[model samples]
Target: MPLQDNLSGYNSGGSDPSLFFLSGIPGLEAMHLWISIPFCSVFAVALLGNCTILYVIKTEPSLHKPMYYFLAMLAVIDLVVSATTIPKSLSIFWLNSREINFTACLVQMFFIHTFLSMETAVLLAMAFDRYVAICNPLRYTTILTNSMIAKIGLVAFARSFLLVVPLPFLLRRMPFCQSHVISHCFCEHMAVVTLACADTRFNNIYGIFVTLFIVGLDLTFITVSYVKILRTVFSLASKEQQLKAFGTCISHLCAILIFYTPVVLFAIIYRFGHQVAPHIHILLANFYLLFPPMMNPIVYGVETKEIRYRVHLLFQGKSF
Candidate 1:
């Protein structure tokens, strides 16, 4: 009934599948110290940038509108996502502390997936905000009131929590007869699930279903919303007004691309790149997780006039 015996085969003996070993760029363990430096820099920037976004939005009364509210929600989600993965990954890379307790790993996975889902929900809400603003300008304020924003935020949180709560349990129930060494830097859902010695057909199918129903559906709605916004913009009589209207969405669009493109790439590689280099897969996975949090604030700070103005004033020691 010992763990060593259980590792040979599932259900043969009782194994404490309660600990896992994390790896940092397999076959390049010697370079883990060097890798930690860039990762640390990225983490610092992500935290600082998201904090700045939160501060600017909170301080600048003009940014208290629905769009900026959604932006602030996004910053919060980015912060959660970054915090869930970066610290443990850094420890593994820098200190060679690669062992993680099963419960702690599950907790990390829960927060990561929950925040990711919330992010998609927030983006969908933002797209709706833009749609209403452009298509029904007169009712924008009335429709997306403070109360409505609160309701939407609650729904996003609830949806993410309800859906992802099953994932950790699902993983926990699986028999891990194989090695506990995870090939990636973090405890991603698919990465952890793939380690189970039992057949993972159900887990794989469920993961794909969640992706299609939750993330894919949000993307579909966001795209349709943007198409409608574009039509509305083109219908404007004044060219300048049309340009101004379209410009407002550039930041959100860029943020969407930054977040989703890497994700889609990682998913594709996970499914079809069985023959690809292990390092390539590891690097892409880390990039997808870290890139958005680090770049989102930079995109918003530069693209949004109000945020840019507030940032400039903050740097100049001027009052808002």
Candidate 2:
């Protein structure tokens, strides 16, 4: 059946939908103000932490290696993820302004998905960076040159943008005859599409395909890289050298865990946890988006000596 015909039965009224209402937290209206406080704090920390990482990376010449370069990219992705969701979420919580224009919602969804895909790609690239540094130390610099880094960055951005560009249009074509109320804090693609009156099989299928092909593939590569890294580390002659080599990966591994674990969990819950409480789904959705940006910088700052040193210098008012 044709999509428009399938949606023709839906009573969309005479006017096309122009705005969407975001349900911040169902049945917890009284606690929204209190809720916004911690959310605001987390958002602030994420912004400060990521911005600081970017500033330190930009100012410090010695931190211009492939690993740090990937870190910088990850910082940018974190910033994008935070920015796309937090401010509007704060507005929804504090000011009670929940109506988002159709165009703005589409824009937000595009960037969120784009940057998320880019983040996975960046993490994969970082894993590859670690693999080279640990397994092929002598050729690390030669392999991951400035040009190569730029190419990787370009490819990541392009892949994400191309893959997600169709999503907004797909949603736009659907007739949202059901309530225009998004049940989560931000403008998630699935949340928006679920309101459509027409068959959303294509959307669901495409979403899963993107998840499996783009994100799943990245996860597989990262796991393989780490497995290889572990093999190489175990074969080292000295325990000190083994520990030292593994130490460099601690931050990246922590980052991978923080970013991917919640994402997978949320996906599982969204797919199979239909009986779960609405608040559980809502909270998990928010956490999946918020926690990584807030925690990634802290993890990297504490685990990476170079970043820590540079951050310390900045706090001491010393030039990098």
Candidate 3:
């Protein structure tokens, strides 16, 4: 049998609840029911929360502005991310030694990359929206028309699809002659690529370059955009307008901080932090990917009055 076939249900060590997928979820901690329960709970919350955001934006005309248009895109990306990782995680908690075929792993990896790519693009779009609104108020309408926004969304999805399409092909060509045990919970690009017994210098280099190009470049632009936004907000005619703009940005800022902080930490841990504590690396990975999706909608609902009110009305019927 090929190495992939051999690894169908292979456990690196004796079946410990922590190391093996107890039910069927990969990298799930079956022994630590406490941890698994919380992870599942938050995963459900993020899925539902992002879904609700999409529903509300689709239904409500008031939220059809450029800002909310970008927000709706963000909601879709978060939903994809949550959906992609959560089931595999839950399977580990519920089913012991669950098997995922090589094809299935490739599919999961594709979605992970696609959603992450879209997220980076949406963040950039949001930054541009704010820049136009605050910095060039007169042309905001002209620049961010409905057709234009739709084109932006299309471009983002196309970019994600094109970039991630080659990943599975690369994986298929590589020879995994030895270990099939993946270190990370999910079929992360780096984690999976590292498992190949043959040299993966080209794959690793391409992966690193792509990550830096997407995440690093996006972050740099976002920072520059925010700096310009701050300058514009400060120059506003009234304190009230400035405060409102600041309030509008708070949720986006919070999302950026949560999203980026873990990414940087993960890079450090995956590279240097590995020597110190293995569990620390795992814990950081979980937090970095899982926590932001769970908290993003909650933060937006609290900071954006429209979303908060709509969500409240959704739960509390009409009479009140």
Candidate 4:
């Protein structure tokens, strides 16, 4: 009897799958070529965009401020996040290489979750930068100094690593009795978690705990920072000043929505949407990971005047 996957309706050859199989898109394999076009295009754009932001920030003296520092960090993170899954996803689509070893899958699981958490923390840090720059202009530089930025980066990586490193170990100890096919593009945490036959309550609980702890807590602080920023902007004496103050936040606001909205929706649906068609869940899961990396550089580069000016200068044969 062919095995049926609850989430994706994917079928497996054997009752006990030795290697995890990755799907490009469930029920849409015939369109893999067409799908690969967009995925590849986005991947290229993400790489080029992030690299441009990093290069421009690195070479431009004026972009050495805390906000640009945070943006550079974001560019690096977006590059990693996009790299972790997109290549393999494209491989699955283009070369028909859908199999992934358990060890390899766990590695993918670790990087994707950990780096995304780092991105979240970096976003929060950026929000704080905005908050201080708007609310306490004189103190912005003194507060978010180079050393402070380095420390914030350190904490973001450390916290994400410590919290998420255990997840792969937890999954490793579990035995798989059902089809080990991950119905999504990459080895998504919950998608892999659902394959284990043994008790996964601990894994499930811990995953949720980490997600809430990192995402929930960071989003809260970012919200508070933004609210304060809004108050400061609105209190500016002139309408032009208020608009200018508020304009600086547009990129970050877009980033917050582009990143978090899909994440929260995906997390909720994965946990509780028993009735959801697997394709929708899988698409939402892919959206959260893919969309942000492709959008972040575009968002920041277009919104931040200094970066845009430098980019134009670079194109016009201007050095540095």
Q: Best candidate per TM-score, number?
A: 2
> Candidate 3, which segments miss by more than 4 Å at Cα?
1-32
Model 2 residue pairs with clashes:
none
Per-residue C-alpha lDDT of model 3 across residues 1-320, encoded as one tens digit per residue: 44234355454432331222212223333354556788789898898888888877887778889999998889888888888887786665555344556677778889988888888889889888888887888999999999999999999899888878888899888766545566655777877787676788888887887788889888999999999999989988999999987777887888888788888978887877646565566667777778878888888888889989888877786421
Worst 10 residues of 4 by lDDT: 1-10
The whole-model lDDT of each prediction reads: 0.88, 0.89, 0.77, 0.88
Q: What order do candidates take by lDDT, descending?
A: 2, 1, 4, 3
Quote the positional error of residue 34 for candidate 1 in Å.
Answer: 1.4
Model 3 pairs in collision: 22-95, 22-96, 23-94, 23-95, 23-96, 24-91, 24-92, 24-95, 25-91, 25-92
How far in Å is the alpha carbon of 213 misplaced in model 2?
1.1
Which window of 10 residues has the lowest lDDT sum in candidate 1? 5-14
Off by over 4 Å in 2: 1-16
**True-structure lDDT of candidate 4:** 0.88
Give stretches of model 1 more than 4 Å off.
1-16
Pairs in steric clash, model 4: none
Model 3's alpha-carbon lDDT is 0.77
Clashing pairs in 1: none
| TM-score of decoy 3 | 0.88
Q: Report the lDDT tens digits of candidate 2 across residue range 1-320.
A: 43233234222431447777777876676789999998999999999999999999998989988899899999999999999999999997898877788889999999999999999999999999999999999999899999999999999999999999999999999987657777778889998888888999999999889878998799899999999999999999999999999999999999989988999899899889999998888889889899999999999999999999999999999987
Candidate 2 lDDT score at position 34: 97
